[model samples]
Target: MLIKHLIGAAVALALGANTVMAAGFASLGEGLTPLGGEKSGNQAGTIPAWNGGITQPPAGYQGSGKPHVDPFAADKPLFTITKANLDQYRAHLTPGQIALFDTYPATYQMPVYVTRRSGSAPQWVYDNTRKNALSAKLADGGNGFTEAYGGIPFPMPKTGVEAVWNHIARYRGEYVVRRASEVAVQRNGSFSPITSQQEAMFKFYDPKGAYADLNNVLFYYLSFIKSPARLAGSAVLVHETLDQVQEPRQAWAYNAGQRRVRRAPSLAYDTPIPAADGLRTADDTDMFNGSPDRYEWKLVGKREIYIPYNNYRVSSPDVTYKQLLQAGHLNPAYTRHELHRVWVVEGTLKSSARHVYSRRTLYLDEDSWQAAVVDQYDGRGELWRVSLAYLKNYYELPTTWSALDVFHDLQARRYHVQNLVNEEGGTIDFSQAPPEDSEFKPAALRRRGLR
Candidate 1:
């Protein structure tokens, strides 16, 4: 199997093709797992092989809207990593994670759990991923992809940008409606939640849709603020474009005070996300999003690291936000970490590009294409922020996605949290009926704001 992969890589290089093809296994479920991870486990046998993942909901799973039951509820932590024994586990930790211990020695700790490779998607997604591995190619210089829809565009990624594209185009669901809250925790651990209702249609992943139907649009999203009188009534609409270099992302903002929807040109790149208080950027919303043209990406290969995984406890309704949110980071008691293989991709900002982050490193899970951890650096070659995705498989949708995305600022002694639906009734509804195209337009933003 190893020789087959080497021969395939050699053939690709000899052909001198511009299309970045997978180094091994032309199709899925061969030398690769269904979603393109290594089919076999490591030599140590700590991380188990992908055994068809969580295809069905476990016992006591009510539905999509209710809290999901943790399948590993009976499992306990194998060991814990703390400042006291940081050196012992230094080989399996990221620099940003090690910095966390240094920043808050007393409260920071990681409860390592047994690795359960519970990442799976719908059967159709697996089918599409196999087809994509043979045909999909990068377009617009890594800013967009072609001949790919409904699944990961680069499952057996060959380049750094290809790995990032897999994360960008990975299937979440056809459509989803989620009501969640955002909070920018202050240095003193005080926070005022900015709750909002969000709806999105992944046009690229629509079962009935085709590449031509996309019309260069990736997804349509509309977010309406629903809390704290002063911040309520405001809304934002976005048309995420695939080829961002040729056609940048289109965004609009509806201000309650002005009662008008205006084009938001400064909503991309290093633009600060609203309500995040400069703790996160617009592109930093989903670990990383938008264009990859600003930076030169390099595939740094794979490494085994301890990352947050199967984190159902942190987002459980039984655990309130007060208990979860702490000073330097989220409370470690509710979090779960496991060792898994991750593709390390580094993006260095181009000389011509002007952005806040000079360098960015993404840790992409091998099983799912999700970017589980990200380390962002500033111009002075200093680590500025670290982002973590608490990934859990939504058994109903059968997709692995983040329950909560946390960004910690090492310098400011603050952090920003997104997608906090622990207290919300409906949680995340992946079965949402596909919304009309008009509902995501700028005109709709004004109409909804007026109502």
Candidate 2:
């Protein structure tokens, strides 16, 4: 079986040769045609972006087909990063970055296959649905099916995982079956259920098993584009789950001007992130508070996915967009139209990558692409930290991604929680608005009490 899978993978590699080379430097803007902006085409008169083979219409008009198309349309990604290209791309990464990808291929290299669905909602919507389904599955016990190397139990129940996997598989199957059916119907003007054989062809193959060598290729590709920058004034709170009551645990980003990590403001139920300089402090209490200074961050990617908010799905009809966005729970502009493919990253302390728990692994959902789940280990390589993000859905947004996220730290028995829902009477619009620069600043930490 493995041999057959390998042979099939080799064929795929051969077929994807051009795509692999194209992807190797796609970040360099080679062979792509730009669109929807002032500069739409390249010097050779070809579009600067990949338009999925759709031709643009006259000025001020949208494409007759679909306005929103898959960015990776036309060509499929070939061989993901493996030992073969590790050295080739290693020069472009930091040592910590290198170790992050090298740690796990099974969880990271899971191939995200795209099925072209016509009359489908925008790519962002599909992206959200996929993520939401995955989250729902995890919450229900999908995490239990597979265990990590160190006997770390999966988080969810078998039933939940099966249900969620079925949902995801069905969605993917429908897209694939529908596309094939559409093509056939287009030619013959008739319709029928997809054949079992056809379905088998798509379902039987495992991208992870076949392409194990190419794990983490997507991260490398994303790094080539725009990497995540640290939010200068952003304040983040890591909620620790002790025996019982959730307290106003604190940590703050250091505002260099004030030269301190002061005690951040205690967040109300839900508050809009204030402007960057609304509060500034030079005291450790104001910044980091009393928390240990043993963590780091990196922006992977952004996409729309569901989160837990207000005890139910915020994106559902019962809730209003006005309430969610005002309280800093939802940002329609950044998440609404985004089909984010997130980064699979790791975080470790400054002391050493070889701490008692050598490393920590994080899987960040692309849409509302926050770090949703974290897997940590102890110095003896035993699984120690299991953090889960309970997300709330933000309805008014185009995607069903989360607006509020609560992190559960299993080992430390604490919780790190961050909620972006709007505060009452906050003057932010739910419509398309860019994220404020201050929202990510260190000073904002002191004001929000999220440090």
Candidate 3:
């Protein structure tokens, strides 16, 4: 018995050592490193990198019009990449472009928590937190309160004509309930039940209010992408995990010159297609960020680390930006927490022969597989564009990821931004996406006056 006990102790110690080593060197591949400049930290302050939790209350925390505090204030970033010394890190890039990392550290830093194996359902995490003091105020007592008080029991997808019914059901079910809760809270100075439709409508359309809160849950669902089969004639929704209704919906790329939207073709995994002008066509499509056809995608890899989102941190992103930078541009954000786990991906024109940017680099959140930041290059190998997408959780939908906002930068001083929301009594159904080729044509763009 004594001998056995000694052996067990020895094994336990060995295992603990191994785990520590593994965590320290959890690289996605040969080139990628943690968001920090060094793999490990020293006595000096944590290496400067992007810090997401630092922003003030109104800027960082959202929901119930309440403010939340940052938990990792001590772990703030120590450094960031700049115009200087960008060349020294070129060999590490898979897409070969330098992007603005510090400008949006939450988007660039890989998340490590995503890689942590959690036996608990993602919904339970939020649910349990809500039952606690901090999050309890936001909890609507689960499905019962949501249905009896909030309005709709379930969220409907945002899409087409059939969506009209979905909107009505949601309005009657969830929206009504939410408004009641809000009015009761105001009138009695405590949580009250919604009693009227007009009150609900007021809450539904009020720009300063929340019609529906569904960001995290939606992202949780979207994180389930796992080698889904490619669709017929439908562009492969590659890059981030495909978990949302808006994720796989077909899209038409708008051709401004022709004043039309063309149905984009789906390309096989890693299969390159040549463009008519010897350039490559952007091959991926989906609904986030304007529409599909706005960008192309290439599979990178899976790995682990910390990332910036709301108040918590996670690990993801396996690829690095070493290969995708111009000769001398630097990444502005380079904090420690942002160097968590991630899946590095590449997006470019199908054929390498012709493209405004020969290559683009994307850092996808490993847990959610959502594209956080993208760096694009010009034909002359100059850094041209940088894009960022923010993910928010959805409580009602449960297990899905949705974009809160999207931003883009360009050499020609052109830029774009967008925000998404689920409006109360609003008619938007994403579940039943239009038939594959139905709305993705030149005539469709003209009819909608988008072109």
Candidate 4:
């Protein structure tokens, strides 16, 4: 792994990106706010500065396991951005956002509201991030890092890859289990659901595990498909690594029909996702996930973009599949967008890397390090797909993650959205207890597979 120790204005100038907080641990929580969000509010008062996020769920919320109530249910959109008025907001909108209008001018619209910087983590997380600032350095070719555990790895990121790393290493929670569905919708708004029970244990956030104990693994994931006769009982296991360059991700798949568990090295990169119909790629799963080994990422400076944020209405239990899903996009009235600051990073596929996306433009939320929108290009340099993530606070953990992640294929007029359980109750569990290492092994995959 290639890691450099250059932290200064020179690196920023060379990389063609704006440098944020000063180098070192002392700057955090002082001049630099926790989680790397700007401490001061924007001049226009449209975007407020970071305050402690929703530590306690909204007043009516039934605690950690219940459906989260919309804290901003009474709040209204400041204005709506459509194709007619898009030009005025063009500078602030990502190319993906603008393309949606061109594709569905009449139906696709963004209900933009005031930006709320509500990203927060536990106090221990903040403390760990401050310590990580002093030690975390890039790994070989910038695909991995060392000397950092828990917290944001590089708060004052200098390179484009560093910014990407920050997004990859961002905290979701210590451990979480979710029951959700991934649906692929066709042009006529007809859809088929792929429901699954998934568990993720972020070893990076394991308070008991120290830096040395991480063993290059960031998280362990298991997805067990629960429905559809043809796909039922299919399961996937992944041991996502901290340094994928040194050791590739360890993946295993259990075939319900075959009754066999086998190693699946093809889980990463641009491979069509196993459960997804053909609309999305493996790396496109988390808006943008997996290895950075195939692309040359560049920091393009920060910009204000109208992105999905604090979207409780989208996650409200009142919505149903019939009401939420539409031909070209989700029901606009049920979605919410906010004008917020985001770090723009572009990835150009390497000549040697064999992948579908020739180029990708990623917009990472400044406060949460989550991808708000990603523009994907085909080999011919034509815009092919756009990915959007509706972010909401998992209030008890006080972390922001995708409530629903949608990947729209512009050419096909189709899209795939994961985690659409609005009509269902209590889909996420933050047990604060990490999974045992035994559960992620191949033997366990076989044991858990239905015979």
Model number with the top lDDT: 1
Among these predictions, the greatest TM-score belongs to 1
- TM-score for candidate 3, please give it: 0.33
Per-residue lDDT for 1-451 in model 1, tens only?
Answer: 0000000011112223344443453536876787778867888988888888888999998998788899999889999999999999999888889999999999899999999999999989988877776668788777888887788877777788888888988888988888888888988788988778888889999999888799999998888788877777877778889998889888787888888778765467887765777788878889999989999999898899999999999889999989999888999999999999999999999999999999999999998989999999999979999999999999999899999999999999899998999888758888768978888887788888787
> TM-scores across all candidates?
0.94, 0.27, 0.33, 0.93
Better of 3 and 4 by lDDT: 4
| CA lDDT for candidate 1 | 0.84
Native-to-model Cα distance after best TM-score fit, residue 331 in candidate 1, in Å: 0.5
Off by over 4 Å in 1: 1-23
Given candidate 2, what's the lDDT at residue 45? 33
Give a tens-digit lDDT track for model 2, residues 1-451. 0000000000111223476433532322123111001112324332132233222222332221112222333333223434335665554233333333354222222111221111111343233332222232121112112211110011111221222222112211110100010001111122111111010111111222221221211110000001012222222322211101122333333333354454444332112122211111111111111112233333232222221211223222334334333211122222211112223444454463223335555544322233444455556655543433333222222222223332222333222223222221121122332233343244443554332
Candidate 3 lDDT score relative to the true structure: 0.27
lDDT comparing candidate 4 with the true structure: 0.79
Stretch of 10 with least lDDT, candidate 4: 1-10
Q: Once model 3 is optimally superposed onto the true structure by TM-score, how far is the C-alpha of residue 63 displaced, in angstroms? A: 6.3
Clash pairs for candidate 4: 1-140, 2-140
Candidate 3 regions with alpha-carbon error over 4 angstroms: 1-298, 302-308, 311-337, 352-358, 379-382, 391-406, 420-451
lDDT of the structure predicted as candidate 2:
0.25
